[model samples]
Structure formats: structure tokens, C-alpha cells
Target: MRIQVFAILKDFFKKEFELNAKLYTIADLRTHLSLLNPNATPVLNRCRFAVQDEFVTDEYTLTGNEHIVIIPPSSGG
Candidate 1:
């Protein structure tokens, strides 16, 4: 699956990357990513995931062909 990351996540992973593992759900992907980069776990826990422009829950299923986006929290004043 192709993943696009934003904010602090982009610092750990690049703006875009690909994962060919068999990830069944958003939750699975989250775990896998955390395992890949333990330092990103805290941020990943708070990140929101989206597919096809719509926010998805951790239970959301993955077909392995969709382009996923990982958006981290942002704050501005």
C-alpha cells in the first residue's frame, strides 16, 4: 500500500512511501508502522488515517491497493 504522511510523521517517514505487507486493517497498519519505527509510536497513536479522502476508523479494512494518508495532529495560534 502507498502511504502519505504529514506533519511530524513526515519527519520519521518521508512524505510518501510504500508497504507491501499484508496489512488487514488500519489498526494493523498502525501496529506495523510502530514496529518499524518505535520512536514514532507516540505520534502514530494520535494520528488519523484516511483513505480516498475520507477519514477511516481503526477497524477500516485494507485491500492493499488503496492510497493511505497519515495525518498527525496540528496546532496553530
Candidate 2:
């Protein structure tokens, strides 16, 4: 499975890198992310989670074929 990093998430991640992983749920993915950066948790919790562009909840299960993208809410003029 692969997940995309967007907006400020890219900064926290240090890059817009693809995670080549095998996580089954959004919560499962969170655990992996927490290991990488403690700063990621609050953002991860508030962000919109999508699989192949459609929004999904944290309980949503992942399929190997989908592309997951995490995007935090943006505020600007």
C-alpha cells in the first residue's frame, strides 16, 4: 500500500514521500506514522483522509490497489 503526503504534511514528513507499506486500516497507518514523527499525530487526526480521491474515515480499511492521500485543512484568502 502507498500513502501520499500533502500540504504541511509534506513538511512534517520531510518530503512528499510514498510509503510502501502494508497497513490494513487508517488507524494502523497512524501507528506507523507516529513512529516516524510525533508531530504527525494531531495533523493526522484532523486531516481529510482519502483513498483514490474519495474521503474516508479513520476506520476505513485499505485495499492494496488504492492510493491514499492525507490532506490537512487549509485556510487562506
Tell me each candidate's RMSD, in Å, in order.
0.9, 1.9
User: Top lDDT: which candidate number?
Assistant: 1
State candidate 1's TM-score. Answer: 0.95
lDDT of 2 by residue, 31-53 (tens): 88977888888887788778777
* Candidate 2: pairs in clash: none
For residue 68, give model 2's deviation from the true position in Å: 0.5
- Give per-residue CA lDDT, model 1, range 1-77, as digits (tens): 99999878877898999899999999999999999999999999999999999999999999999999998987767
Report every candidate's CA lDDT.
0.94, 0.78
Error of 1 at 36 (Å): 0.4
Runs in model 2 deviating more than 4 A are none
User: TM-score per candidate, in order?
Assistant: 0.95, 0.78
